[model samples]
Target: MILAADLADDRGWKGPNSATPEVVELSELLNRAKIYPLHDRPENFRSPSSVSRKIGNLIGSHPSAPRNALRTSAGEVPIVNRFVDDRTPMKRQAADIRVRIRRGLL
Candidate 1:
């Protein structure tokens, strides 16, 4: 969610297209973090499509989201709000997560 929010803030909303570079990057990051195991069902994997959907959800839940944003789940609102209200910490955590993933510590 933090990464997606950062992407949206940096690049603006790109919609939920798996082929988009933003979604693909996020998917790659998630996969590198081992968010989904190869032995798991294909549908359970954090593929580009899944990342796009999650991005959509996070964008939609943001208070300043676009008019055409997707309908967000209630459970996601607080997270989105926190990301918006405390971006510096959220970004720091995201960076930490990325470092851990790269170092095989996640």
Candidate 2:
């Protein structure tokens, strides 16, 4: 559960560019917003499932998601080799993707 504010302040992390319009809008909204971790908040800070459900409501699946989806061709592979300066192998990328999916992060 990475916080957006932390990513915004980390100097060593070269995160996604904020020059895009969507990032600019999000930055404007997050200005001066302080997010305390659950342990530091009030007694009724809420459980993780409640937070997850709220987030799912905000940006989760759409009613017509399946209908509007883009289908890839049989040979199409979506993985890109940009994690390191040197190219990472497709097999490693596939394995990493499987791990992430297993951990419910995908």
Q: Indicate which candidate wins on TM-score.
A: 1
**Model 1 reaches what TM-score against the true structure?**
0.79
TM-scores of all predicted structures: 0.79, 0.21
Per-residue lDDT of candidate 1, residues 49-106 (tens digit): 8877887887888787776778788777877777778878877887888788888786
Cα lDDT tens digits, model 2, 1-106, are: 1222222222222233444343343343333234444356555343333333322322212222244333322221111112223233533554564455456555
CA lDDT of every candidate: 0.74, 0.32
Which candidate has the top score in lDDT? 1
**By TM-score, how accurate is candidate 2?**
0.21
RMSD of each: 2.4, 16.8
